[model samples]
Target: MTGNLTRAEQKQQTRNNIMAAALKKMSEDKGFSSLGLREVTKEAGIAPASFYRHFSNMEELGLALVSEAEDALQAILLDAKALEEKGEDIVASSVQVCMQHFRDNGPLFRVLAREATGNSPLIRRRIQRCLMNLNHQLAEIIELEMRRRHRKITNPLYIAEAISTLVFNLGIASADLPYAKQKEAEKRLAHHIRIIYWGAEAMANSQHLSRNIMLS
Candidate 1:
């Protein structure tokens, strides 16, 4: 069922296929630095020189893959956010979303998490941007909750950043560790979130009480 295509359309399709193959290979193996262009080209079933036509180098290709992974993760988390607003427990919904995402996209997450910490400035920066975006989204949610309660949020950004780090680490740890270890880790993570939320609520209440006392 081969259809006729314009030259540009065929070239674009080939490039997309190459990128897809490269992403798949990177997901399977965490060591992106060790991957050669020739190997990727072979896996992609394209000439080695053809790789250069799509990307300047393997690092460029890796950055593209990282971007794709970031988008996919954002989509999953956004869906979870929608669920949270519909009477779902926030922490439970978040954990479920993360677990499902990891189960479905383990390879992409593995590659990004493993290589983003290395010497590649581009990959590192892209990963950092993704983290920042996540933090911003969480901060907005926290601020919205605060507003709903008529509470002032003095450090929502910092709180969001901390929570974002916690969530990211939870995802990475759960994905990388053994099955038994992952279960234990998830329990610990849920407990940790509860403690954090409880402490914040207590602090907010104390602050309110102190303000009332001062007014009196």
Candidate 2:
């Protein structure tokens, strides 16, 4: 099947295979920090030495997985944000899409959520970096929306960090619930996000009013 692909494509395929194998191992109650190279290589159907070609070591592989999760999450959040321009409820839209993504890519997301506080400091730091990246991206999006509405917030990054933390925490929680309960989780998440936005807007208005009063 890989015969028709170019050399670069084949290497990418092997790299994907290695990552998949690692995910599979992690899904079975094993943390990435505890996984051995030989076990992962065997699962990937590649020789142990071949692993070095893709990743320097297990830590590097774990970082790759984190990178993939970061990209997937950014895409999901951006897609939900885009819906807000179309009159869709961004909170509900984001929850529904994010939950669906968790369902579709459970292992990938589960690893990310678990490793965020796992025993490995390297993995934990990488996860923190991923969340920080998401926070900044989300802040930019929120800033644009605020500008569009002629609104001002003291710091969009704070709001972004709050929203990102809440959504990710709730999203991970929802992943463990059954389908019916997941729906309830979605409602809770959407409600929480709305409240955050509402408070932010109220503060911005109050600030605006205070400035006008002083000017008057």
lDDT of 2 by residue, 1-216 (tens): 889999999999999999999999998989887899999999999999999999998889998999888878877867867876665656656678888877767788878888997888998998998888888888887777777767767689999999888877777767878989999988888888888988998898899899999999
Cα lDDT for residue 184, model 1?
A: 78
Q: Ten residues in a row with the worst lDDT in model 1? A: 145-154
Q: For model 2, what is the error of residue 112's alpha carbon versus the real structure, in angstroms, after optimal superposition?
A: 2.7
**CA lDDT of 97 in candidate 1?**
64
Considering only N, C-alpha and C atoms within 3 Å, which residue pairs clash in candidate 1?
Answer: none
Give the runs in model 2 whose Cα sits over 4 Å from its true position: 2-7, 119-122, 149-154, 210-216
| Candidates' C-alpha lDDT | 0.74, 0.85
Question: For model 1, what is the alpha-carbon lDDT of residue 57?
Answer: 85
Cα lDDT of candidate 2 equals 0.85
Instruction: Name model 1 segments beyond 4 Å from true.
Output: 1-13, 24-30, 146-154, 176-186, 207-216
Q: Candidate 1 lDDT, tens digit per residue, 1-216?
A: 126888788778877787777766776654778787887889889899988888988889888878878887787668766865675666666766666676667667766678768778888898888878877887777666666556654467777776667766677657767778877777777777666666667777788889999999
